[model samples]
Target: MRPSSTGAPQRQGVGRRRSLGVWLRGGAPGVWLSGGAVAIAVLMTLGLIGILAVRGLAHFWPAEVVQARYTPPGLEARLVLGQVVEQETIPAERLRSAGIALPPDSGETLTRELFKLGNRDLYGSDFVWLVGDWLQDRQTPADALVLERREWGNFYGYALEVREEGRQVAKGAAAVPELQRRLLRTRDLSERLERLEKQDIGGVNHALERLRLEGRGLELDGRLDATAQADLAARRAELEARYGELEDQLASLRQERRRDSVVLRDVEGRTLELNLARIVRAYQPNAMGLGAKLGFYGSKLWEFLSADPREANTEGGVFPAIFGTVMMTLLMAVIVTPFGVIAAIYLREYARQGPLTRTIRIAVNNLAGVPAIVYGVFGLGFFVYVLGGSLDQLFFRASLPTPTFGTPGLLWASLTLAILAVPVVIVATEEGLARIPRSIREGSLALGATQAETLWKVVLPLASPALMTGLILAVARAAGEVAPLMLVGVVKLAPSLPLDGNYPYLHLDQKIMHLGFHIYDVGFQSPNVEAARPLVYATALLLVLVIAGLNLSAVFLRNRLREKYRLLEE
Candidate 1:
């Protein structure tokens, strides 16, 4: 030991050199950084999933439905623009936020609020007029105003067109920036129009009554006088001819107007639509029964899952979007699996590894990094326009402008997503194929089996486990993709399903709706964001479940195949 002191010094020098080299390579720092990054990513993913789960589970939380009336900011009167006066007003947002589920007299869904100053008595002393400020001093009376709490953009469909001098003129009503020269209240238009028609007819009757009682139309001995009779005949004949001519001119116009008319309200009989802002403003606590908690929860569940699309904001369920998502994903998986597996077989079994193979590998890797929205845009361009046009011409030339394959639909969306995910599948399957030993192929060939027989019976069976793993990965990736499908087929709302009883009912060219797009539509695209918050959470939860279920199915298949093929390698 005493003689080894010099040797120990040399060994220590070598150890010091190794330590210095390790530090220079930054191994510790790199590992720490990588681990930290992975930890952060994992935490974020888990946090999001946790939040969704908590919210979804809260679907069973104790919730009470309350109905209440909304009243706007209480302002007696102020200088709307400049001049100040005794003008009465309420806020519109308050009504939207505080909507109560109330049916109109005839069972119409109208977001209505009872107001004190809205007596509408021409001679009433308590009548209040809505006033707005003209900057500082001047004032203009608003035609109408309602207010409640709600996020912006929830209410967009309700539009009012006030005619002035034979043209639509903006009368002070609901104030949405884009709703110029129109009226917008989340109330049913057909009901409103009918009520207005009745009022106008009453006014005409009242004017006639006044003319008869207070003017020259008084009867003499219960019989009309000569001059009165003559005047009545003349007037009747003139009006009848004029009315006849006008009715003829308006026959076609009325039908067109109904078809293209802007939605006025979300009444029960109308289509399923909502203006969340308007709903929130109109919402009120205690609007629905709160005490029967069990019944209420049951109803809410039904509403959440099975309601149909409705107009005037009547309750329709989110079933359509759910169907679209499931159908599209299933179709995409089915379409992609065969094509991807076949491509992998050719690349691994037949094609020689060369520059072309290297180039393909590079392209596949690069494709995985491309932005999803770009895929959507490409799908819209290539599939919807170019390929769809060709399909239409070949299959349904009779339905030119009516659109068969000429519009974005579930089929186009599935195909686009399949194409987008093909590279993932190819990479995974090829890697799986690579794992099969050459000895297995040689053994199969030595036993009087042809190359095809060897590939089918020996090599393929051995590689099945890896091929399935690739499919699982591809499915997992495809299920979560939203951007591309949005451009290809998903819509905010669709009137009918992709499968309907039309000519060639399995029409793949109609624009169908999906849950992911619904989230985007309800959260950001809505006119009122606050009123739609709960709905947004619900939709998000559904989307996560859909994605998870798809991944789980792939996993189940992978596990089964792995177990089945475990003996081959051994």
Candidate 2:
């Protein structure tokens, strides 16, 4: 009886084993593992973006200014003031091991606070670490002001007096309001001065240089004559007159900029005079409401996006970097798109499917795997040293000593990135071309359409989305590439933008700033590490957004092309 019943249990066990084997054979384990890997990857990406967003966006928000009375072991008790940027708790034993004497009543863990003690000129350091036990009477004063200046980092103090031309316009807390009004006026004057110096006067200087070079060229060609000399002299006279006028205006602006000064007293009661013109902005963070803080955040974000950088690019705006990145990427897209599409078309449609063609395709694919820095080296050698030098010799002989085109600049940067991105485009476009139904081409040919005509009108339109797909990939890679750009044209700081109000607005020969390089500079090469920390995150987040924006635009165009041609395919 048991043997007959056991046959059923044996059969059941065998069935269960069979089911397990089926599950394993179906690749369920591998599927689960792959799914886990993808989920982890997605989480990691989101985490990175979320971290960047929080750290970057928070930098713009107005933090409450704290005034704490701190006393070291042997030092006199005095008011220590700043924005408390970070706080960490550590084991008391670890603090003691580090030679920091803990208070007798301290717990097992000791807290250390990082204060952004700005006012670099006065304090010699922008940050300080204080033991929590040493900090007493910590308070956020409503009148504690923060002055974001064009130089010397920042000032945290109480506004004591406002003076205009040695006369006291206001005194005590009342002076803070007057200081604000004067600061606005000074900022306007400074902006005007900047425009006059960078644009109006800078243009004149450029013209003069060009004129001198043209004269040299004339002399080299034996074309210089009394009439030419007279014309040159007259033009020089006109430029000189303009320069003098600008100089007078600049002097007046400078005088205005210096007419007002602010007297501020720090937490230690030390008084210092700051010129109103130097202050980019001022706010009482502790006094600010939610709306005021939000408005301040908006203004700061805008400044980061729109303003020219100052303080070794640790402060102010990254407009030049943003502009350069977009311009270079657009130029790269303009260049690589047609070349890549053409090459892909030739390989897929025109060229014979032979060993040579296969070899070329293999080489193109291998190019995508090449180290980016190798491309930088090639660009520096071939594009800059050789190609640019030749161009300079041929067309810019008049500006030989300066070597206008024979330098690392915007054109070479675009070209280098275009070269870097072409392989990606070629592969994408080739795949796209391969996906197109052969009957579409054959139908066009049967309808009396030439191969060229079919490609241009029908095949190409169908593949336009893929063309854009390739472009999207190209732009995403090109915009964030710092290595090739550093060798080609990128700089830490560029005084003038490549595109400006000058004739021949797009200056391909000009060295430009890039957001990727800017992030590198701010994050790694900054003089004030603590102060520059937030800027690094802000710039990085902005760069990510910019790349995303460009890619999205291309994606949008691709989707539109797909929609527009979907009916054609059907």
Candidate 3:
């Protein structure tokens, strides 16, 4: 407790009263330490973010141009197109086909530009290295690095041009003995069970026949033996028990047979051994020729952001992922806004302050803290499997075998994101609602407005800016989230948008693409990952910018609305 200058208790701090000066002196050190730690953390975070931003932007800068003529060392062996032409008169196409692009063929033959975009693979395979002639200077680089196509190997692993079926056969050979033994064991067990089942039935039928024979003998005035009667009783009970056991064994055998008889496809050479040894031996030098040189800088940014999803690495862009991310975020905003607002309104205005509201408030806050991946599981179960499944049956029965709601797609992505965003929206809206003056509601009621009318006409209007502010926060959170989206819809690639020009154009079963996923796929998964590194940074920057842009727009909108409402206080 701190006493005021008037010698009255001005501040309460515990059970005892204390002078403000003494209290301040005692607590200042601890306050400063905690504050310094916070400040340091904030500064470190900003510094790291600044570095990433700068490095990423720098990657988009164009390299200094150099003109160089094709020349080899005095020993002289150069590989191009399929034929090694003389250093002089080597058609640009010959070099271009091997992954080098010839200068603009504004009037050159079609053969020269044939490999530009449509045939990128032609160059990627042969032209693994580049050398600059440095045309401005008389000397070509003393050395040019190159890949020996005849002996091509790289860090990504060696591509052995072998039949996949041959590989599958080789792998299958390794497992043949074990597989054969299991198959034989299963077949023998099935036969044994079937034989025993037949025997059990026969024994039961024979027992009944013996009982009839004994009954006929008794009816014919013949005395039945006591042993026979005893035997019959024991035999009947034993047979009945055996019958039950046999039935169970037969059922078990049937299930085992079904499970064991899965026909695995024979190896047709459709698999490749991932060669790690050759990969370790691949040359990794940082050198570039004219065509490869062009891939960096602003052109790298443009290609990465604008490319379509391709089969391997030779072709494609990230357009689908960018489209999906933006579309799903917008959809989530549309969905979460209304439900969150309504929930906030009920909780803040209509509900009485009691244990239930307190409990609910605690639960909502806890939900917000749950790890996002857990939300992905929940969405997969509830939204995709439960709700989307039902929708597929009702509206997409004709497309069975192929899933509609059953597969990951855009609608499911939107719904999953909306669920994840709800807590954020609810918390934000509640805070906004809390900040409104109670007198505003009272004034509206005083003017003869119904509770709902007053809420809609006065309270919400005054709180509009805050509501928008809350929604902005919700959208920002939902847009950047990747884990939940991964489980719901994001794939490495997609052929078409969820919505298109065809009849009932929205196809939600198709796994959609997304930018966050693209960065992951290219950086870690690409065979040409060494080259894709710069592209990865370029894509990451785009994603950050997109989310930033969204946040900025919402901030601007909130400010405008806040300004408009503030004037009324005058």
lDDT values, one for every candidate:
0.59, 0.91, 0.59
For every candidate in turn, the CA RMSD to the true structure comes to: 20.2, 2.0, 23.1
For candidate 2, write residues 281-342 as lDDT tens digits.
98999999999998999999899899889999988899999999999999999999889999
Best by lDDT: 2
TM-score of 2: 0.96
Query: What ordering of candidates by TM-score runs from best to worst?
Result: 2, 1, 3
**Backbone clashes in model 2, listed as residue pairs:** none
- After superposition of all CA atoms, the RMSD between model 1 and the true structure is 20.2
- Cα error, residue 16 of model 1, in Å, equals 15
**TM-score of every candidate relative to the true structure:** 0.57, 0.96, 0.56
lDDT of 1: 0.59
Clashes of each: 80, 0, 17
Please state the error at residue 366 of candidate 2 in Å: 0.8
Candidate closest to the true structure, highest TM-score: 2
